[model samples]
Target: MSDITLPSTPNKLSRYEITGYILIAAGAIVLFWGIIMFDLVTLIATGANEEVGIVFGEFGEFIGGIVGSLWALAGVFLFFATLTYQKREFELQRIELHKTQKIFQQQNFSTLYISFLNKHNDIINSLTAYDINKSEWSGTNFFVFFQEKVLSSFTQKVRTKEESAKTPELLHSFFKDYFIYHFSFYQTSLNPYLKNLSVLIKLIQRYRAETQDAGEYYSFITKAGFTQSELFLIYHVARYQLLVEFHNIDHAFDVFEDLKDELKVDRIVQQELNDENYL
Candidate 1:
C-alpha cells in the first residue's frame, strides 16, 4: 500500500480560503459591535427614530447571531479549501488503495470508499424527522433540528438524572428505546452511514497494523467531511454503546469537550453492563 499522504499544513490560500479570512475579519467587526451595540446603535438613534426601543433591544441577538453564523460560514469555507487540497494530494493513495480490494472486496475498494463518502448526504437526505410542530425536515435542516431539538434536549435530560444513573448501560438503553420508538425511520436510514464510518476506521487500523507504513490514513476516513451534527451523532452513537461494529471511533472525535463526561457512569452500573450474564 502506498503511503497515504495526509493533508499538510497548507501554505497557499485559495479564493474561498481568502473569502473565509475576510469573513473572519468581518466577524471580528460584528463581534465588537455585538458587545457594544445595544448602547452604541441606540445612541445613534438620538430619540429620532426611537426605534420602537424593542427593536433596538434586539441588537444583541441580531448582531450576535450574525457574528456567530458568520464565523461558522468562515470555518466552512476554510474547511472546503482544505478538503480540496487533500483530495488532490491523496490521488496516489487512492490508486494504491486498489490493492486492498482483495481484502475489503473483489471490486475496487478505492471507488467503493469514495462512493460511500459521496452517498453520505444522500443518507442524510433520506433521513426524515418531525420537529416539535410536526414539520418534516431533511438535509441540512435535519441536522439543525437534530442538534437543537434532539441532542440539546437529550443533554438536558442527562443533566436532570442523578450521577449514579448516568451509566452508559442505562443511557444506551434509554436512547435506543426512545429513538427506535420515535425516530424509527431516521434510525433505519442512519445505520448504513454509521456502519460505513465504523468500517472505514477499522480498515485504516488494519492497514496500519499490516503495512507499518506510518501515514495518516485516518484522514481518508475523515474525508467524509462531517457536519457538526454528524460529528455529534457519531459521538453520541458511541456514548450510547449502540454500535457493535464500531471501533477506533474515539480517535475521530478530536477530543470533544464531553468526551469523558458522557462515559462517567456509576461503578456498579459499569460492572453490570460488562457482565454478559446480566445482559
Candidate 2:
C-alpha cells in the first residue's frame, strides 16, 4: 500500500501571521526602493559623479520629508493593528476559558453521576426484604418479586375499586398506603436509592438547562447498565412519583421511557404507565 499523509490544517491565527509576514516583506522592498534606489536615480539624473555631496543632501531631505511622514502613518496603523490583534487574542482566550470551564463542569457532573449510579447499583446490591410469608428476597430478585408478585397483586386488588387511584394525587396516596406502609422494609431499602435517583435526575436536568444537552443525560441513565429488574423497579417509581414530594424521582420518567419496552408486557401496568398521570 502507498503511504498517504495529508498536510496539517493551519489555524486562523497562523493565516493572520502569514499575512503579516507578507506585509513586512513588501514594506522592506518599498523601503529599499525609496532609500537606496531613489538615490541612485538622483545620481543618474544629475549626471555629476563628482557632485556627490549635493546628491547626499537631496537624499537626506527626501528621507526627512517623505520617509518620516510614511513612518509616522505606519506607526499609527501599526498601533491600531496591534490593539486589534490583541483584542482578537483576548477574545480567543475568553472562548477557551469558557470551554475549559464547561468541560470541567461536565467532568465533575459525570464523576458525580457515575458515583450516584454506582451508589444506585450499590443500593440494588444492598437490597433485602421479606414478603408476607417471611420468604427472603434480595437485590434484583427482590425487585423482580415485588414487580411480579407484590405490585401485580396490588393492581388486581385495586382493579375493581371505584376508589382506585385515577389521579396523580390519589395515586400518590395509593402508593404510600399500599406500597410504602405495607412494604416498609422494601421502601426502607428503596429510600436511599430513590433519593440518589432524584439527585442524579436533578443534576442532569440542571445541566440540561445550563448546557442545553437535550436528552444526552437520559442516554447516560439508559446506558448505565441497568438490569431489567432495576428498570422495572424504576418505572414504578416514576409511575407513582414515589418520594417525589421531597425530591425529583419524577425525572425517572426520562429513564423509564428510554427503557419502556420492558413496560409493555403487562397490560394493566402498561395502561397505568401510559396514564396521563404517569406519562
Candidate 3:
C-alpha cells in the first residue's frame, strides 16, 4: 500500500492572538466588576446616616477603593500585554509577506530563464551544425582562413593595377552582390541569435543587480534543474557569441569563467576549453 499523507491545516488563531483575546476579555470583565463594586460602595456611603452605618460605609469605601485600584492596575497590564501581542502578529505577517514576494520573484525569473535558454539553444544548434562542417578548424585556423581567404583576397583584388580601368565597375558589382549575400546570410542566421544573447545578458544583469551576488545567482540557476552539460553549452556559446558581436573576447571569457566557477562546472568547462575544436 502506498503511504498517504494528508495536508496539515493552518491554525485559525496563533497562540499570541489567542492570548491577546483572553487578556482583553479578562480585562473588560475585571473592569466591569470593579465599576459595579465601587458603585455599590458609593450607594452605601451615601444612603446610610447612623454612626454604625457610617462606620461600615467608610470601611466598605476603603475596601472598594483598594479593590478598584487593583482591578485598574490589572486592566492596564492586560492592555499593554494585548498591545504587545498585536505588534508581534503584525511583525509575523510582514515576514510572511516578504517570503511570498520572494517566491513570486523567483517564479518570474524561472520563466524568463527558460525562454532565454530556448533561444540560446536555437543558436547553439545552428553553431553546432556549422561546426560539424568545419570539424577540423581550430581557433587559429579559423582566423587564418578569414584573413587569407576572405579579407586578403578581396583587398588584393581591389588594389590590383592591372584592373584599374574596370576597377570601378568591377568593385561596384562585386561589392553589391557580395554585401547583399553576406548581409542576407547574417540577417537570416545571426540576427536572432544575437538578439537572444542580448536579451539573456540583460536578464542576467538585472538578476545580478537585485541579488548583488554573482555566485549566488549562478548557483540558484543551476539548482533550478539545469544540468552541468547544458550550463557548459550556454557558457561556451554565449562567450563566443559575445566575442563575435562585441569584439570583447577577454570580458566574455572572464564572465564565463566566473559563471562556471559559481555553477561548480569548472571541470566540464575546462575540458571544453582544452578541446582543439573549441573556439
Candidate 4:
C-alpha cells in the first residue's frame, strides 16, 4: 500500500535561524571594518621613511585612519542588518500569535464537549435513582406539547453538527422527537433530589454549549425528571436576580454566576445520591 499522506501546514522560519542570521550579519560588519583598518596600517608603514621617529609617527597616523574607516563601514552594515532582521522578527511574531489563537479556540470547543458530557451523565444518574423508565416521546402528542411549551420559548445559538437539520422548526422537531422517542420505554418519574434551582442551572449550562431554544431546554428538564412548574420557577428566579443586579447591562452575568453557584449544589446532591445507592 502507498504511504498515507497528511495535510501540511505552512512552514515558518525557526527562532534559531533568525538568531543565527543576525549574528552572521554582525560578524560581517566587524570583518569589513577589520579589512579597512589593515589596509591603512600598511600604507602608513610604506609612506613614512625619513627619520625612524617620523616613520613611526606616520605609521601610527596611517593605522588611525584605517581604524576610523573600518568603524564607519561596520556602522553602516549594522544599521541595515537591524532593519532586515526586524522584518523577519515581525513575521515570526505574527505566526506565533496565530498559533496561540488556534490553540485557544480548540481548547474552547473541547471544554464545551466535556461540559455537555457531564450534563448527560447527570441526567442518566438521576433517571437511574428514580427508576423511571425512559419513554419514547416521538410521534406522540407529548412531542407536540414539548414543542409548544419548551421549544417555543428557548433561543438557539449554535450549529455544530452540519448534517443535522438546524432550522428553528426542524431543530424543535428533531430534539422534541429525539428525546421523547429515543428512550421511551423508561418509566417516567421525578428525581427526588433535584430542585428547580438545579434544573435551571443545568439548562443554562446546556445553553452555553448550544442554544437555549425553548424546546431543547424544556426537553432536557422534563426528561431529567423536572416538572414544568420547576422550569418556570427557575426561569423567574434567574430573571429576577438579573434585574436586581445587572440592572440594564446587555450581558447576563447574573445568569452565569447563578449557574456557577448552583453547580455546587448539584454536586452535593450527586454525592448524597451516590451514598444512598451504596448503602
Candidate 5:
C-alpha cells in the first residue's frame, strides 16, 4: 500500500461561524438583560405614581420590546447562518474522507501481489532468455528505444507537410493498434511489470472519468500525498513497461508530463532522467 496518511479530523471552525456564534450569544444575553431591567424599572415606578408609572412603563416597554425583538431576530439569523456553514463544512469533510478511503483501497497490496504472482513464470523466462540483469535497464534506455522504434517508425509516413495533415488520424490509429497489440501480448506473456503499467493507466482513466476536469483530477492525485520518489518510480516503471509492450510512447509520455506538471514535480522527473546513464 502507498505510504499516504489519511486525513485527520479538523479542529478549525467553518469560515465566519465562530464570529457568528459569538455575536449571537452576546446579542441574546444583552437582550435578556435589557428586558429584565425594563420590567424592574416599571415595577418600581408603579409603586411611586400609578399614572406616571403607566406612561413611563408603556414607553419603556415599546422601546425595549423593539430592541429585544431586533436582537432576537439578529441572533436567529446568525444561528441559522452558522448552521448552514457547519453543514457545508461537514459535506466537504465527508468528500475528503471518501476520497482518501478510495485512494487507500486502490493502492492496496493485494492487487499488486496478485499481478506479480500471475507473471512470476513469465518474468523468470524473460530474464533467463535475455540473460539481462534488471538493474542494467533504465528508464532512459526504454525511452530511447521507444523514440527510435515506436515514434519514429509510426510517423515515418507523414514526412512531408501535406502528409502531416493526416498525422492526427495516423496517430489515433497507431495508439488504437498499440493498445490492442499490447493488451494481447501482456495477456499471453503475463508480464507483471506490464500488468502494473496497464493497471496504472486504467486507474488514471478511471480518475479522469470521475473528476471530468483535468485540474480537479490533478489536484486529487496530488492531495493523495505521494512522495517525489514514489511518483518517479510509478511514472518510470509505467513508461518503461509501456515501451516494452510497444504501446503509444508519445501518448504515454504526455500523460507522464501532465502528471509531473500537475504535481509541480517536473524537476524530479528531469533529475531522474539526468541521473540515468542510458540517456
Candidate 6:
C-alpha cells in the first residue's frame, strides 16, 4: 500500500486551544524566570560570608523554582490531555452521525419516528416559560389559553410515562379518542406544524406495525403505567400537537408523503428487532 499523506490546511482553532496556548506560554515564562532567579541566588549565596544569609536566600529560591516548574509542567500536561480528549470525543460523535445517516437511508420509518419523538420533547420543554409568565385568562379564549390547556395535559402524560408507565395499548386508545375529538373541532389547532405532526403520526403507526414482540411492547407500556396500545396513541397525539406548533401545515404534511421505500423489511427481522431494545 502507498503512504497516506494528509492535507496541509488544518481546521480552525477553537477557543479552548487559544486559551491552552496562553496558559502554557505563561507557565513557561514563569518557569524560565524562576530558573534565572535560582541561578542568581546560587551565585549570591556562594559569595555571602554569613552562613544564615546564604541558607535563607537559597531556601527561598528553591521553593520558588520548584513551584514554578510544577505549574509549567501541569499547564503543558493539561493542554495535551485536553486535545487528546477532544479528538476522541469528536471521532466518536462522527461515528454516531454516520450511523444515524445510514439508518435514515436504510430505515426511513425509524428515522422519521425518532425525529417525531425528539420534536415532541422539544415543544413540551418550550411551554414551561409560557405557563410561568401567564396569569388570569380573559373571558374570551385565546390561542395561548388553548395552548396552555393542551400543554398541561401533554405534560401530565409525559410525567406519567416517566414515573409509572403501562402497556402501550391503553395509552394508545386514550390518545386515539382524545385526538379524534379535539382534531375534529380544531382541525387548525395544529396550525403551524401540522404537516410534520401528520408525518410523525404515520411514522409512529408504521413503527407499531414493524414492532412484533408483544411482551416487550407490553413491558415498556407497563413501565409507563399504560397499556401497550394506549401509550402509542398518547405518544402520537402529543407529538402531533407539538409538530403543529413547530412547523407549517405544508411541511408537516409533506413528511407523511415522503414515501420512504427502504422501510419495507423482512417479517423475521422486524420481529427480531421488536424483541430487541426500543432503539
TM-score per candidate: 0.42, 0.60, 0.45, 0.29, 0.36, 0.26
Evaluate model 6: give its TM-score.
0.26
Cα RMSD to the true fold for all candidates: 31.4, 7.9, 13.2, 18.4, 13.5, 22.4
Candidate 4 C-alpha lDDT tens digits along 38-125: 4545655665545545645654565456544555565665566566667767777776776676568547745654565466445534
What is the descending lDDT order? 2, 1, 3, 5, 6, 4
For 119-195, candidate 3 gives per-residue lDDT tens digits of 66656455422233565433223222322232234445455635434444454444334333433443455456556
Ranking by TM-score: 2, 3, 1, 5, 4, 6
Between candidates 3 and 5, which one is better according to TM-score? 3
* Tens digits of lDDT, candidate 2, 1-279: 122243333354444455555555655566676667656665777657667666667766776666655665556656666776777677777767777888898898788877877887887778877777998888878777766664565566556556444654544444445554444646777778767766766776777777766756455653466666666666655554565533345343445554556353344444553665444
Clash number for each model: 0, 0, 0, 16, 0, 39
* Candidate 6 wrongly placed segments (more than 4 Å): 1-13, 37-91, 94-279
Question: lDDT tens string, model 5, 1-114?
Answer: 123344454578644555556655665676567557556556665555766567566656765676556556656766776777677677778778877877675566346534
- For candidate 3, the 10 contiguous residues with the lowest summed lDDT are 139-148
Better of 1 and 3 by lDDT: 1
> Candidate 1 local accuracy as lDDT?
0.61
lDDT scores in order: 0.61, 0.62, 0.49, 0.42, 0.46, 0.45
Candidate 6 residue lDDT tens string, 1-279: 122233233466555566666666776676567557556556565655686466556656765566556566656666776876678677767767765765564477545556665674453333222234666433122334543344345335534663234434544444444445544545453332345444554554344444532232322321333222223333444445544333333232223233222211122123323434422
Model 5, runs deviating above 4 Å? 1-65, 113-121, 124-250, 254-279
Model 2: per-residue Cα lDDT at residue 244:
58
Best model per TM-score = 2
Q: C-alpha displacement of 82 in model 3, angstroms?
A: 0.9
